[model samples]
Target: MSTLEPIQVGLSNALLAPERPLPPGVITWNGSDPSVRFDVYRNNVVVSLTTALAEGFPVTRALVGERFFAAMARCFIADHLPSSPILSDYGDALPDFIAAFPPAQGLSYLPDLARLERARVQAYHAADAPALTAQDLACQLANPQRLSAARLALHPACIVLVSEHAIVSLWAAHQGQGRIEDVDLRRAESALVLRDGDAVLVLPLSLEIGHFLVALAAGAPLGEAAEIAAAAGPDVDLTQAIVLLIHYGGIAAWHTPGDL
Candidate 1:
């Protein structure tokens, strides 16, 4: 190993684990203890990163309370260090981490809640694309035959998530739209996430609509996606879902199979 490698390792370890002594050769003033200086820097980094996480997952913090959330953040930061320079993109693995976290086992809905929050963050950072308007889609699908083979592209910011918990209701409650006491915990919920103008919108989705959107996002043709939605449950309203998708600016583009 190179001489610098050991120093790098030492610095990294010192930052992640405060109990470790400072690595040798870190220059310090004659009166200052190297360990103390390193501890100061280490605490600062952790605090900054933790604050970023709190900003990204405010609902999660609210659910777990401040003290518990801080402890959880500390453990997560140590296990999963940021790989990218963008602080906003940090905590991508938090949902999975929460899923497997021993202390959070009782809260099965916590992981899905985290996933919903992460999706919002991702939607906020997603690239912009021109939304397909109802008129535009209608013009393209003038022929029923052509409509069957049409493949629709979702907006870059669109995401569909199906959850066993009433995550959408929970999220909405915490956002001040409703009282948490009224949420039906026994009900399952799905979510459709997309950006509307400058803000990210999270809407509750029916199972059929959720399946249909997911299939379309995966490049399925219109007819096939409709079939998928119908298979999900009885009286699946594909038309209503399509209308809502257009209203939400979820569809970015569309082309018949022949166009490809």
Candidate 2:
């Protein structure tokens, strides 16, 4: 390491920690005390990151209220700094952090809500691809044997989230779609998040459809994925699932054994 490496490390360590004394070698133009300046910079950095977290997880913040969310965000920031310069790329670990956070333990659904919001952020920034049209999918899966063995490539923005809590309803409720009081916190829900044009949509899915989509996303063939969904729920409607995918432009491409 160079001579400045320790200085850089010290500055980085103290940037998010208000309790730490100012790192050495930090000087202002006036040659006055660096402590006050350093403190201001630290507050700006923490507040900027906290704001990013709030924007990324609006529903999560609304659930806990601003003050509580800010406190939790400060705690999260002290440990989890940005790995990438992109503001949207930050807070991927917030869901896991909330799961382990002591004060947030009472709201068991908050973690999954964070996860759902994080997925929305990721979906918004994911790469774009041309989705397959209904006719295209129909043509590709015309043959029964080929259909059984066919593999699908989902859109890059496609994401599936399954949670034991009513994350989909909770998130939608905050968006003015429904009443928060009407939502049953204990109910399990799954969501399919996909970017259509410029809008990111969060569509509710049945438990069986969630399993099917999860299996498909993992590269399972159609027949095998359908079987998994059936195992999860006996009344798995493969046709309905396929229709949903086609309607939402979730299927990017399809490949048969020969193409594979």
Candidate 3:
């Protein structure tokens, strides 16, 4: 037998608005003002979900002011309910929602910026691992026979984003109090967000580099992944990409996952 989602639509609707009437004889009161008690639940839902959206899309929040951020967040929350029990996963669909939102029609790039932010939070919570060291790769290369069966792993906190807008430039510019410059919407860009040591760095990736990382991240072996990257951009400089990944802790180490 199939299971139904336990989070009922009525509870969701009630939590979103205190004024929404509940099922009969199910008054929410514990001797306190019933209205205030219900307000607590309603307030918690809005605040918690709104905060999640804000944290997931700081750039988007910054692009529009606080009032509009709240409005957009409320709209998002109404149309989408969190599927995961974990609060961190609450805003996963927000980027796509923003892209389709009619009011944000003029800001086509907003969704991509939200994408960057969402990836950032996920990277922050990714599993920790000791990224591959320079000496490790060098030693592995010393033994040519190890090539065919060797494997590589991506770091737990690595996230790669490929977008056609200058999202990184736009994100960096407005993160601080400076005169934000006008950007050409026609520009293309990509970025790699990863946690290195104590800091999360959002590094802009060259088109070829981004494509290469995307393939490796999808489980392609290094040699073939390098070929795809090179084919895309002849001057990809695979060594440089590896250096960046190692330096930023985006890749752990290579290993055959199921090999005995």
Candidate 4:
């Protein structure tokens, strides 16, 4: 196989990058003014890509007016080409791009907000797992010391996010314009995103809970994560966070680390 064939194949399928013209023998259309025919395809290509981008970053579009949104979309398309056929996965680089975009500078938390949105979408597709309930925990918590060293299992859809700005407010505000008058944008926040059955929920997390989840995600034992959470923030309530984790999908089950 020649290198040019693979290049042609890639260009044909890639929706986000510039369309490379095919070799002379690759097409059936023969016309003196071929550019006109090609223009139709080019327009379709641009529309398809722009539409996907707009769907992915509607918040970004809302923040930056429509004209600038199209311009930024063009830049984003040129810089990072689509690596997959799935349009939903197209804008993973958008948050990073927004951080560097000059006009978007005023929205300092835009990147984190984008991250939160992406996590919500990804969490929606995460594999399903049976969640632990209070009844299940009542039986499992019987061996209190054993539970400490055991590896805690987080649900497949559980995700934790940490932000330095009020991204949670940004996300909630975008949910509707009603509470827009009451929200103060200066507050800092963090959140946990998880799936319960078919619904995806983004619940607010206290700073201690966020740190505890991060520690658990880092493979810290339950006892160690609680300790780390305490060391970082003295007010951390292990019992409460643990209960919520089990309640929300942050935790699915407990197991002795080496048990077969």
Candidate 5:
């Protein structure tokens, strides 16, 4: 390792940890105390990271209030620093952190809410692809045997999030689609998040549809995916699921064994 490797590590560590003393070799141009200067830089770093977290998980932050969220974010930041320079990718682990956070234990849904927000961010930044149109699907899946064996390639932005809490309703309520008071926190909800053009949309899905989409996204054949959906709920509507996918531009491609 280079001689400066330890110094780099020390500076990186001290930047996130306010309790640590200024790393050696850090100095100002003039002969002034580096402690105050270092502290200011450290504060800015933490504040910037905390702001990123807030921006990424606005719903989560709102649920906890600004002061509580700031404290929690600092705790998280001290333990987990950015692995990438991209600020948007910084808090992928925040959902898990919120799950284990002592003060946030009472808000069981907060973690999943954070996860939903994270998925939205990911969907927004995901690579663009031409969505498979209804006409394309119809022409490709015309044969019954081929249709049964067909595997779907979902849009790169597609994400299925199944939560035990009403995350969709809660998130929508915050977006002014519904009243928060009307939402039943105990009810479960599933969300299908994907990008359509420049907009990221979150649509509610039935438990069975969620399973079907999960199966399809995992490269399962259509027949098998329908079976999995049926197992999740009675009389699973395979047609409705396919229609939803087509309508939302969720299907990016489809292939049968013959096509391969």
Candidate 6:
């Protein structure tokens, strides 16, 4: 290891693990104790990171009380320190962490909720794109048969999520848009997340429609996607799903397979 590697490693360890001893630097004011100073710095760093996690997963924090969330966040931080300098990019692994976390096992829907929160954060920071309009779709699909062979380009900030739990309803309840009292927890939920202007919107999707979108996002042609949606269920609502995608700025562009 290089001469400075040990110091860097030692500093990182000292900051995240309170039990680790401070690095070999002996400098202090009048030879005062270094552990106290290090402890204060370490606490501040952990607190800031924990607060960031709370901000990223407000619903999760609310689902589990603040104290419990903080404890979980601390464990997550110790195991997965930020590799990037950007704070907004931190906590990307939190959803996966929560999925396997012991304390969170009782809250089976927590991971999906965390995924929704993560999607929101990613959409907020994603590169901007002008959404394709209804006119654009009409023009592109002027020949209805051509649509089956055409691939629709989704918005740069769009994310489609499928969860076995009614996570969208749960998310909306926490955001004050819907009432938790009315939600049936056993019902599965799907969603389309997108950012238009400065706002991030999460719209619930029918299971079949959501599967269709998944296919589209995976580069499937419109015809095949529709087929997938149809096979998922008899009531796919192809028309309404198309309208919703166009209305919500989900499509950015599209082209037939032969266009390439």
Give the alpha-carbon lDDT of every model: 0.89, 0.90, 0.78, 0.75, 0.89, 0.87
Candidate 1, residues 213-242, lDDT tens digits: the string is 888989999899899989988868887888
The alpha-carbon lDDT assigned to residue 75 of candidate 3 equals 87
Which regions of candidate 4 deviate over 4 angstroms?
Answer: 1-32, 177-183, 232-234
Worst 10 residues of 3 by lDDT: 1-10
Which regions of candidate 3 deviate over 4 angstroms?
1-13, 17-19, 26-40, 143-151, 177-179, 255-260
TM-score of each: 0.93, 0.93, 0.82, 0.81, 0.92, 0.93
- Model 3 vs. true fold: TM: 0.82
Which structure is stronger by TM-score: 1 or 4? 1
**Judged by lDDT relative to the true structure, which candidate is superior, 1 or 4?**
1
Candidate with the greatest lDDT versus the true structure: 2
Candidate 6, residues 1-260, lDDT tens digits: the string is 69889888888778887778888974688788887777888998889999999998998899898999999999999898889879999988999999999988988898999999999999899877888787766666567777778888888789999888999999999989789888787888899998867899998899999899989999999899999989987878988888887887888888886676
Cα lDDT over the full model 4: 0.75
lDDT tens digits, residues 1-260, model 2? 79989888888888887678766777889988887778887999889999999999999999999999999999999889888898989999999999999999999999999999999989999998889997776677457777878888988899998899999999999999999999999998999998877889999999899999999999999989989998987779888888889888899888898873
Q: How do the residues 47-156 of candidate 5 rate in per-residue lDDT, one tens digit apiece?
A: 99999999999999888999999999999998888988989789999999999999999999999999999999999999888888877867764577777688999998
Q: Write the per-residue lDDT of candidate 3 for residues 1-260, one digit (tens) a residue.
A: 12323335555567877778643334544555555666777888878889988877878998988898999899898788687879887888998998998889898888999989988888888788787777767766666665645556778798888788888888888776334676655677889999966777889888788888888888887767777788877669777888898777666877643445
lDDT by residue (50-119, candidate 4, tens digit) is 7888877676677676888888878877787689888777888888998998978998888888788778
TM-score of 1: 0.93
Model 2, 113: alpha-carbon shift in Å? 1.0
Error of 5 at 35 (Å): 1.1
Off by over 4 Å in 5: 1-3, 27-32
Query: Residue pairs in steric clash, candidate 3?
Result: 151-254, 152-254
Which 10 residues in a row give candidate 4 its minimum summed lDDT?
A: 14-23
User: Against the hidden true structure, what lDDT does model 5 obtain?
Assistant: 0.89
